[model samples]
Structures are given as structure tokens and as C-alpha cells.
Target: MRQVIPLGTVTMTYPGPVREQPLAIELHNTLYAADGEPLDGLADERGLRAWLGAVRGRLPAQARGADPRRLADVRRLRDAVREVLHAATEQRPPRPSAVRAVNDASRRCPSSPQLGAARGGGMRAAIDHHGADATDIALGAFAVDAIDLVTGARRGALGRCGAPGCVLMFLRDHPRRAWCSPACGNRARQARHYRRTHP
Candidate 1:
């Protein structure tokens, strides 16, 4: 059941951000699909600030207060994290550029980097980051989590939503869980029902 809302000239095609998972997954979900086209939840400064506020508990004070204007850098990190995780899920190598982005952001702080086997079998960075620059520290924190998630035990738990036209990631913490959310589960079921009836 889709409902249209009156929003003058512009309208949203996708559902709002579903952020009940790990920080890295949350970041990857910031860019979701809408009406078959990719949409970015953090497309603007306000969106970035709002997302930062939503995840404040997981971030440092400095990161929480990061200037929203640095969204470009934030998006770069998101892209890197997204690519790295997707590559992990496929058991393939992520591009060198993505690895560099994760590493460069991690180096924003002083830390002892731990080497972990990346999903594709290459050693990658796993950092216990220390705080530094106002906003960069937040980037560091996010990068650190992405590293840990893709290389840590939870790596096996990472999953992409199975619903059609949905581009969200989640941790399949429970054996029975597959969709990103209950709504997506319903969507998948509805599609299945429609296909069975129509065919």
C-alpha cells in the first residue's frame, strides 16, 4: 500500500532511514534506493547533522559536535565503508581506493592499528582510535567501526535486506531474521503473494 503525500514540488520516493543496527551499517544505509533510483539520506548538511544527532550515543563528544559542512568527507567515508562491506559480503576484493579512504580516515587519529583479515583475505586496518580534530575524530570513529565490523566475528552476521528495491544492510543477529525490518519483510511477502496470483 503506497500513499502519496502532498509536498508541493518535491517528494520522497523511499522510506526514511532505518538505523537500528551498527554504526557502519547505519552509515551505509544513509544511501538507500527510492523508486528504483538511489537516494542519499545525508544529502545535505541538515541531514548530516540530524543523522549525527541520532547516533550521538555511539560517537565521541568531539564527533557529535562536528560541523555539518564536512558532509563531503563524511560521504566519502560512507562510500568507502559501503564498498568494503559489500566486497566482504561477496567474498571479493574491494578497490584500492576504498581501502585508502578507510585507512586515511583511520589515520586521522593516533592509534595502534591492528591487522585483521579483510573479507577477501587481505590484511586490513583495525584501529582503536584516539580522539583528535573536531569532526575528523568522528570520521575516525566511524572508520574504526567499519573495520571492526567487516573483520570481526560479526562479519558473518552482516546481511543485505532481501526486499525488492531496498538497498539497506543489517546484521542478521537472529537466525530467523533476514529482512532489514518488519516493513521490508511485509513488502517481500506482498510481492511474493502478488507474483503467485498474477502468474
Candidate 2:
């Protein structure tokens, strides 16, 4: 027989989108969370590799044979991206170090667009890269997206989930949308209802 796990008892896996947002934003959200509970997705090299494997197309290659130092670097980059996003959401200037971190990562693995011949004799658009490894390529993509997110017009759409104890950020795709996901929305509404009925 299968054993059932009780709610709030199991250590949940990553709890956010995989490809819904830019890869950089997704990386920033790897902090699995609930009110007063935050779980780090990149807790170790194994965990980082697992996440990278799950999001196959996001990275040019798998982060195989990652060591503790490499995993720490990835986490550091993620924190920098999160800092930039937070500043953008608040309409404040991003920290100079955060900007530098993203720029540095982007420089490590720059992707250039090129026109290559297709199988049927037509030219197709493709991205060419420099001497970048899997981590560099992935971090470079995130850096590019984070730059756009902070400087582009869509910066106004940056939002943090209003649900109590939940710390997720997202782009507000439409008006009247508040929480990062439907589950968070329901939780917020239920909390409000409970407060009203109890009072």
C-alpha cells in the first residue's frame, strides 16, 4: 500500500514556475516558501544538478560534476539577480555590486545571433556563443533577462505575492491579479475571510 504524507509535513520540492518567467526570475524563486518557512532549492550540488536537469532547455548543457564551490557560485549569482529584481519592483536603483555581478556573468557567456543555413536551403536564425560552459551559459541567459526586467517598461509589472508568509515575486500579467499563483491567491482570500468572520 502507498503511504500518504500529511500536509505541512513533507519537505516540498521547488514550488514555483519552471519556464513561465525568464530563467533568471525562475532561479531567483528557487527559495521554496510558505509563511515563516523558506527552503533553499540549491541546498547542495546534488540539488542544483537535479533542478538543472528538470529544466532541460533552459541551460545549453547539464551542470554535471558540480562541486560545492560551483554550487555556491550559482547561489551567489541567484542572490544578485534577486537583489536587482527587488530594487526594480520598488522603483529604486539597483545596488552597484548587484549590477556588476550580473554584468560579469553575462560577459562570461555571451550569446550572439547568427544566420545559418537551414536544412531546406533557407537561412535560419541561431545563437552563437563564446567559450562558455553549462553554468556560464545558463547564468548568462539569466543575467540578460534580469537586465531587461530592471530597465524595460515591464518593470512596472513587477509584483511580490501579497499572501501572508509567502515570498514569491512575479510580473503582473493582468489587472486584478495579485498573487504569484492561484494557490497563493486562495490562501490570501481565505485569510481575509477568517479575519472577518472571527471579528
Candidate 3:
């Protein structure tokens, strides 16, 4: 059954537009599902454009899940989540300047208390419990990093997906996550397959 969360009651519901540009223009153009789906519709520049339209309003009046564009938006959000995850997990850690920026971004939130809670534990719980779409995932990663940067959490908890050609962020549960998802993993495998066969 489809669950209906109350307005302003959902976890990790950040304010403002998630993207400033189209998918084609973003540094990470392609996204994959764990099952190796191409995720074609929501990967390129047009995908982001479609997503912005879906999430342009507040909850209660938030984007309609039944809207035809909803699926595309969700897909885009997932990609974004992965990207944010990858960034949050970087090994170098946030520099003081970067930490300052993260703090600035967090402070800009209209709902600071909620943001603070998420930064501490709400986001991680959301990801663990409900799982996350691209948007939610991205927000989760952001929340974690925001806490890390502002509250002085450990720097080593962040990570970048190891998938070649895939650039996204995720928490480092272990030392061996190379790709954002299994699809990227498959892509890597296929590339190897082609190289070995062709050579």
C-alpha cells in the first residue's frame, strides 16, 4: 500500500529547488539502478528539468506522486542522492573553508531545527528506515556532512562511489564500495568484459 506522510512531517524534506541546471549540464550525467537498469529517462539534462517541475511547492501541496512526471522526478532525485552521498564520503575531509560553507548552507535553511535534528540522526534513520529516493538520499548525505562539518563528527564516515564515470556520495559502511549502485557495478563489469573479449 502507498503511504501518505503528513505535510511538513516527512523526514529530510529540505526547502528550495534541488537543481539549478538541467541533467545534461550536471557533472554526473548517467545514473543506474542496482539491477542494472539504464535509468535513461532521468539521467541526462532533461531529467533535472523534469524533476524541478515535480517538486516546486511545499508539502500538503507538495509535488503529486500521481503526477505523470513523478516517476521521472523520483529517478532524478535518486541520482542526486547518490551524488551527494559520494561527495559526503570524500577521504580528504572537509577543509575549514568547506566546513564554513556547509555551515552556511545549513543555516540558510528556513527550518533550522528540523535540519539540525536530521544532521544529527534523523537523516540516517530515514535512509535506514524508509530508504531514500534521489532527493531524499542527497538530503541524507547533506545532513550527515552538515553535522560532520558543523558539529565536528568524524571525517572518515564519508565516501565517494568507486564506479568509474560515476560520481556520487554515500556513507562508507565499509572500505570496499566502488560504485554508487549495482548498475554502475555492472557497467564496470561490462566494460571489462568488452575489453577482455575485444583484446
Best by lDDT: 1
Q: Tens digit of lDDT per residue, candidate 3, span 1-199? A: 1112243443222221232222211213334333444444344433433433333342111112223334444444344433343444543344444444434433433231222255556652212313233343333333344454323454454444566654444444566766545666788889899999999
Deviating ranges (above 4 Å) for candidate 1: 1-15, 35-37, 111-131
Can you tell me which runs of candidate 3 are displaced by over 4 Å? 1-90, 93-96, 109-145, 149-157, 172-175
Which of the two, 2 or 3, has more lDDT? 2
Q: Cα deviation in Å at residue 25, candidate 3?
A: 18
What TM-score does candidate 2 get on C-alpha atoms?
Answer: 0.83
RMSD of each: 9.6, 5.8, 11.6
The lowest-lDDT stretch of 10 consecutive residues in candidate 1 is 1-10
Query: Which of the two candidates, 1 or 3, achieves a greater lDDT against the reference?
Result: 1
Candidate 2 positional error at 123, Å: 3.3
Provide the TM-score for each candidate, comma-separated.
0.80, 0.83, 0.38
lDDT of 2: 0.73
